[model samples]
Target: MKYRFPEGFWWGSASSAAQSEGAAQQGGKAKTIWDHWFEIEPNRFHNQIGPAQTSTFYENYRQDIQLMKNIGHNSFRTSISWARLMPDGINVNQEAVTFYNNVIDALIENGITPFIGLFHFDMPLYWQQKGGWESRETVEAYAKYAEICFNLFGDRVACWMTFNEPVVVVEGGYLYDFHYPNKFGFRMAAQVAFHMMLAHSLAVRCYRSLKLPGRIGIVLNLTPSYPRSQHPADLKASFIADLFFNRAFLDPAVKGAYPAELVSLLKEHDQLPVYQAEDLALIADGKVDLLGINYYQPRRVKARMTAISPDAPFMPDWFFENYEMPGRKMNPYRGWEIYEKGIYDILINLRDHYGNIDCYISENGMGVENEERFIADDGQVKDDYRIDFIREHLKWMHKAIQEGAHCRGYHLWTFIDNWSWMNAYNNRYGFISLDLETQVRTVKKSGEWFAEVSRNNGF
Candidate 1:
């Protein structure tokens, strides 16, 4: 069987500034939360590696963009570092502006459309000192920063994402201790999540008011929640999980409002965030023009087997437990289950229930550790697993498109093997592998397969 993508389907991958762009302290870039966190607690990162140790995209973007073209990319997604652009999150840095302008223009010159994201978990440390997203003052400052980005690069960049996976910031920073500002408070997490949505809305409002030629949107890492069985309790658990993890951002961004059930649930738990009278109207006005979905894995949950103590602090997991299905295929390198059909399920849900907005698979790929073991005699990584992973997902994506989902394209998790967050460079998820020591870029077997897919518009 042959599968073909629609005409002009975008082909490329996604990356972030904090993860890939080294020169953390130089180039007039102020310290981000990641930078400050690493400085204070270096051991929190994998192998003691920090944000400063990245792919050096600041100095190597020209060559990197060429590598993108070599992989047959028609579009590429990378974020502008907020702290880099504005050293203090309020003042503009001209040197950073020049560097970004050059990168954007270079991508255009190489026939790759640039998709610029405003925030990718790199909050300026100064903002953290001021309560970060919890402070209404910080939210206003973020809106200003978004406005600055539009005034600076909106003319050249056609796709603008307000934030990439805002939920991760809330979950990692507040609920879990994985990210900076590590704390465990449901009240704080709810407040931060609300503020992030407000900030996103405010940025969208700013973009619309400027009448920018480009489209503005947000990227969400959507993990579909499935129940272990058809029991009523399991079904309820899945519904609640989806409400908190997926629709919390999806409904607001696409439908221009938060889910009513979510609001009632939060209120019942006394976890509602403070908001001004005009916040809802602002959110309603800031609906996205596009959506970027990052699907890595699905969440299989079952009803909680035990009751939570009344004295326990509130958490989303109180209502459910993770259900590991028997004989489920797994990505041994990454420990995530391989569920390709989840992509089609997400797309079909969007089409039937969420207005079928324009969207793309912004980040999807397999991450492997110690990839040197797979290097062939020709010095190329024979990443046949990644190729298979992508092809399986694409099959579902193609089925979704044929069934009337408004999906536009499929981009892998990343273009090059760059630094990850807390995991650092442990898991490499890229078509083009990066030799961290020599900074050498090599096209893997998956890259060759991707080139053919791009050239044929499918596989």
Candidate 2:
């Protein structure tokens, strides 16, 4: 059966600079936190392999894009390494420009549209020394960097994302230990998030200033918060969680202001992020042309009556606790629940509340353990589960479109199996498999299925 997408639907996959591009030290790429951290704590990374030894996309992007075309990608999303382009967030490198230009031209020549992101959690070590995103100077530096990229690659790259999952950069790296600069401080995380939003707004302003032809957007990982029960406390808890995690950024980036509840909560706790009056105006006026939604799972919340911190400093722990509901479908390999309807809910919310902004599923896929187990004797991977994972999500996404949502496309989390942050290479989330030792790329079963979907515009 052939299920066709709407006219001009985009088909592609997504990858990050740090995850796919090796040769980290060669292209005038100053060390990022990952590069520095790997040198110090090799054991922290999976199999002790650092980001320097990725799929080597930096050298093989030409062949890689051809592989993308072979597997069926009319569009592809990838990020520029901040350090690669600027080295120290201050000095621009000509060699890096030449490299990316070649890559952009190659992808375009093969009829693959490039969706480029300005930053993807890889802060240059120099910037990290300067307090990373927590410093306002870093925010300005990012704006300048974005301007450079806009001028350099904007002609061919139609889609520009200001930042990929800024919240994850703050939460995962600052509050959790899953990423570089692993410091568990909510205060610092809040500061970093505020600066990140500022950086995003500044970048959008730069893109607008350039009068670039393509649309500019920001990619956010939006996890819908669900209450575990009908109890008022639980409902309130969920509301607070949503305000903090979802609406804090969503309202500003989409609706052009921070959520009132979030402001009130922060004020009540004396944790309100410092902001200049002009910052509000800039954010309000510098709204994105589109939105990139990365939906992995929904958050289930229940009220927490007791104050969370005993001796620790301020945090948002007074709000709620995550509750894993019974009978939820689980992805054993990734530890995330499968909830296809969440996609429909996200689309519906965008239509009703967020003005139905032009958007796409920027990243969505199933990550499996030991995916090599599925490699067949025919040199193909039998990844039927991945096909199912994507199909289920697309089924809901298509339904949302029928109901008047403005979803433009769907790009899976990755094209080739590559290294992930912290998880390293443990979880495979690609339509194609990669042999790390030989740097060999083989198309998986899902890759063939995706080809047909792209050829037909849908499943």
Candidate 3:
């Protein structure tokens, strides 16, 4: 193989509880924010589809684990639903425990390492009603919940994550109004962001207190910001965007401190979050043992063209704007820019700027609409586009690793077509495509191709 990885390189894909597990109200699981939001605003979801409809991983994990083995997955990641494990976000749910235990044991029996995430944006309806991440009580509840998980299943899990793409949670819930409890404000966003990090630190503390056998970390969707021009304004805009979006969580996750510039910028705007002095001490405890990068696209940034009125709401956009570079590559199906080198830049940045921390490509995949349109006579998707996408990204990743990057693995965004948040199933992102109407699974060309890459440790 020309582009080979290190010995024992982990090859698998990631999944989230709310996105893949379809037994929403079954097996003694309660409602999450996704369920509640779907109930109230069904139209917000595509075709009125919601959390109750998924790939049915909850009912089919054994078969999915066999599929993982068939596709050469040595490691796989999927999160536990907080709403399922702790219906009230405090007490334990034994039925959920047995179900998760069976899933974990099944993956082990299939020779696939289990990477368990404690939270994956599936805030329990119980917690959301308590002000979600806004309330410090929610943070404490989350920490306690983390302790319960560690006590129950830490024995078999190899990796644990506190949260995933926390910036999205901050952006969607507070700044942009894309998620449940959607609001628009920077002050509350700041508070929620801080509390989330604090909550992460608390979870890390709990994991350490028990001295679990595995590593603990968080998965961040790191979007490398590229400036539109060499102009100083454009450069500054890129820096600020990175500060607010990337470093907001990355810095505190790996570095143990929020960027001084970030704090000063928030202070200048009177947007500092309400945090106790001891919170910093706790935040220091939350530094991760591993970092997971979810890179799908790069953020193209430019200086703001127009000034914001003094009466207007303060937001991240107050400092910068996003634009598409003319002639840049695009993923038309998902409407996202495709710059394969962005993965290289992200890995290089981590190597040079973030102490070469141990990390992995936790998610990098292409989502396409109506993938069935490419079905071959063999009754499988001839997704050559997706295969090329993976190869291009992997070439850059291989280059990064050759340059002494501490990247250990690459896991695709998903293993199978599953329900997405607001987009529902509009865009399919999986090596194995699913027919939701029939729950039929068909391995795509990319799946077979990836199996070869894994068996050979390269392309």
Candidate 4:
């Protein structure tokens, strides 16, 4: 059987500035929270490696872009490090500007479209000290920074994303304490989540106000919440999970409003964040022109069997519990469940309930620890497992597209194995493998397969 995508389907991979571009201190790049976190507690990162120890994309972008071309990438997504572009999130760094201009130009020169993301969890440390996303001041400052990006690089970059996975910032930073400014308070989490949405909306407004030529959108890692069983309680649990995790940002970005039930629940719990009266209107006016959906896994949940004590702190988990279904397939390396059908479910939900907005799979890839174990005798990773993972998901994506889902393209998580946040290079999820010691890149089996897929526009 043969499967083909649309005429101009974007076939590429995604990367981030902080993760790929080393030279943390060079290029006039100020310290991001990742850099600061490593400075304060070096051991927190994997193998004591930090943001400074990246794939050195800053100095080697031209070579990397050539690799992208060799891999048949027509479009690629990478973030502009807020700290790198504006050292203090205010002053423009000319060195950083020159570096980025070269990067964008190289992508264009190679016949690849540049999909530039404004933020990717690398908040400037100076902004963190000023209360991070929790402060309205930081939100306003981010709006200004976003406008600066539009004026600087809007001419070359056609596809713009306001933020990549805003939910990760809320869950990792405020809930799980995995990212920087780690805090574990329900109210504070809600406040940070609200303010991040406000910042995204403000950036969207700024993009529109500039009348930019290209499409502007937000990238959300939507983990479709699945209930354990057909029981009403389990169904209710799934509903709440989706509302909190998916709709928290999806609603405003696409539907131009917050989910009313979610708002009511927050108000009832006195967990609403501080916001100006006009903020809702701004959010309404800032609906996205496109959506980037990053689906790596689905959230399988069930109604909580145990009731929490009244004195217990409020958390989204209070309403449900993770239900590990029997015999569920799992990615042993990354510990994420392998649910390929979740991609189709997500697209169908968007099509049926959310107006079938224009979207694309922004990030989807398997991360494996100690991937060197899979290296072949020919000096390439025989990543057949990753190839299978992508193929299965793409099959479902193709089905959804055939069923009238407005999905545009599919981009894997990354082009090269770069530095992951605190998990710094531990879980490699790229078509091209990066050699840390030599800073050499090798195209893996998956890369060869992806090139063919891009060339044929399908399988």
Best by lDDT: 1
Model 1: worst 10 consecutive residues (lDDT sum): 82-91
Better of 2 and 3 by TM-score: 3
Model 4 residue pairs with clashes? none
Task: List TM-score per model, in order.
Answer: 0.99, 0.98, 0.99, 0.99
On TM-score, who's better, 1 or 2?
Answer: 1
By lDDT, the candidates rank as 1, 3, 4, 2
TM-score of 4: 0.99
Q: What is the lDDT of every predicted structure here?
A: 0.93, 0.89, 0.93, 0.92
Q: For model 4, give the 10-residue run with minimal summed lDDT.
A: 82-91
lDDT of 1 by residue, 1-459 (tens): 999999999999999999888999899999999999998999999998998959889989999999889889999999999899989666799999999999999999999999999999999998889999989998999999999999999999989999999999999999978999998899999999999999999999999999988899999999999999999999999999999999999999999999999999999999999998999998898799999999999999999999999999999998899999999999987899999999999999999999999999999989999999999999999999999999999999999999999999888988999899889889999898899889999999999999999999988
Using alpha carbons, what is the TM-score of model 3? 0.99
Q: Model 2 Cα RMSD, Å? A: 1.3
Instruction: Give the least accurate 10-residue stretch of model 2, judged by summed lDDT.
Output: 308-317
Instruction: Judge candidate 1 at residue 105 and give its lDDT.
Output: 98
Candidate 4: stretches off by over 4 Å: none
Put down candidate 2 lDDT per residue, 53-149, tens digits, no spaces.
Answer: 6988998899899999998899999999989999966778999999899989999999999999989888999988988887998998888888888
- lDDT digits (tens) for residues 1-459 of candidate 4: 889999999999999988999999987888999999999999889899999959999888999999999999999999999998888667899998898899999999999999999999999999999999889999999999999999999989989999999999999999988988888987899889888888888888888888879999999999999999999999999999999999999999999899999999989999888888998998897799899999998899999999999999888998899999899999987899999999999999999999999999999999999889989789999999999999999999999999999999999989999888888888999999998889889999999999999999999
Candidate 1 residue 448 Cα shift, in angstroms, is 1.0
